[model samples]
Target: MDTADRLIESTRALLWERGYVGTSPKAILERAGAGQGSMYHHFSGKRDLALAAVRRTAQEMRESAEERLSGPGTALERVAAYLLREREVLKGCPVGGLTQDPDLMADPELRAPVDETFAWLRERIAALLSEARQDGALGPVLDPADTAAAVVAVLQGGYVLARAADSAEPFHRAVGGVLDLLGARVTD
Candidate 1:
């Protein structure tokens, strides 16, 4: 890839691995195999490059979710598919992990992608739940908005729990519990 693309990709990995504060320009340059001059030539500075990386990550997260959510299935099935999709559990949700980064959240520019990603996810899930409710796929008592937030919370919190326990079981259990709560069946 080109130097700029390399830089952006390297930054994206670093941000996911190290968070915004831990990802340094020197490390990004080293990872990208590009020199300081090449970095500067491609982007203004660290923040600029980080923003690009974050935006790319956010887009990727959304697209991946859309793929699963829009696939052939009932609303609950779509959501279950998303929650059960294979992931690098210990590494955490790329966008959700960023929410814990104080430095990243402090900067409006840096935080925008993270904020937008969660907002989009919540809205998409809410819409799905609404569709399910309308079709009587979901129970009458379930509120789309509240259930959406709970689902996201469980997933995000599951990551934290898994990380804390240093095992994937917690994450799986959390997902299974949420599915149980929703009375969603696991169909092939």
Candidate 2:
């Protein structure tokens, strides 16, 4: 790859592993096999490079969701499709995992993509929940926004739990529990 592409790819991988603050320029240069001159030629520094990486991650995530969310299905079917999609659970959310990094979250420019990505995902899920509610698949008083946020949190948290526990069982259980909790019931 070209220097610019190499730099972006290197940053994306490193950011996923070490986070923004934890990843140093020295590590990036070595990882990319690019020299100081080569990296600086493409990016101002770590922040500039990280900003690009975060934006790239956000775009990727948005596109992936839109693919499933917009697919043919009932609200439950669509939601389940998105949730049940296989993932490398141990790797976690490339963007959401960065949210836990203090240094990354502290930088407004760096954090914007991370925040926006999650916000967009929450809104998308909320739209699906709204549809479910309208079709009487949900409680009439259900709040789509809160429910959506909870769903997002569960998936994100599931990744964390799975990663920490070093097993995908937690992730599967978490998603299944969420579906069961949100699924319609006949009880009063």
Candidate 3:
């Protein structure tokens, strides 16, 4: 990778491993194997590099979700595919993880990608649920928007629960529970 690419990738990993407050320019340089001058030459500073990283991460998250959520299957099946897709559960959601970073969250520029990602995810999931309802795959009582938010909450909260317990089991169980709930709402 080029110096700029290396820097952005390193920053992304650092941001995931360490929050914005914890990810230092020096650490970024060290991780990227780039010189101090390289970072400055490629970007203005740490924040600039971080913005690039966050944007990249957010874009990737959206793309991955779109692929699964829009893939072959009924709406419920697509949702199940998304929920059941393989993930590094212990590491947590990259964008979701950023939400815990006060320094990142306090900065609108830094937070924009994170906020936009979740909003898009919620909307996408809502659309899928609405499709399912329209097709009679789901019961009439299901609220697409509210249920979509719950689906997101369960996934995000599952990360926290799993991280807290130092086990992926909690995450799996949370996913399974949510899937069961959604399944129960399925119409015959």
Candidate 4:
């Protein structure tokens, strides 16, 4: 890839592997195999490059979710598909992981994409739940908005749990539990 692209990609990986506080411009340059001048020439500085990386990661997360949630199936099936989708369980959610970075969270520009991504995901999942309720695929008792929020929470929490334990089992169990709860609410 080109210099700018390499820089952004390297930053993205660094941000995922190391939080904003841990990811250094020097490390980014080393990872990208680019010179110091290349980073400055392409962007203002580390923050500028980080913002680009964050935006790209957020966009990718949204696209992947949309692909899974929008696919054909019952709403419950789609939701399950999203929850059970392959992921780097130990690495954690790229966008969700950023929320743990104080430096990143303190900067509104850096935090906006992360906030927007979760908001969009909750809304999208809510829409799916709403559709299911309307079509009698899901029970009417479950509130779409609340359940969506819970779904997002569970997924994020699963990542934390898995990371803490240094095993993917916690993540799998959490997902399976959520799926069971959702499945129980599905109408005949």
**TM per model?**
0.93, 0.91, 0.96, 0.95
Model 3 spans with C-alpha error above 4 angstroms = none
Clashes of each: 0, 0, 0, 0
Candidate 4, position 163, lDDT: 95
Looking at model 2, report the run of 10 residues with the lowest lDDT sum. 179-188
Tell me which of candidates 1 and 4 scores higher on lDDT: 4
Give candidate 1 misplaced runs (Cα > 4 Å): 184-188
Q: What would the per-residue lDDT of candidate 1 be over residues 75-132, giving only the tens digit for each residue?
A: 8889889999999999899888888888899999999998899889999999998888
Q: Which numbered prediction scores highest in lDDT against the true structure?
A: 3
Alpha carbon deviation, residue 59, candidate 2 (Å): 1.6
lDDT of 4: 0.94
Taking all chains together, the TM-score of candidate 3 against the true structure is: 0.96
Better of 2 and 4 by TM-score: 4
State each model's CA lDDT, in order. 0.91, 0.87, 0.95, 0.94
* Candidate 1: pairs in clash: none
Sort order, TM-score high to low: 3, 4, 1, 2
Every model: Cα RMSD to truth: 2.5, 2.1, 1.1, 1.2
Ranked by lDDT, the better of candidates 2 and 4 is 4
Q: Tens digit of lDDT per residue, candidate 2, span 108-158? A: 988999889999999999999888888877786678899899999999999
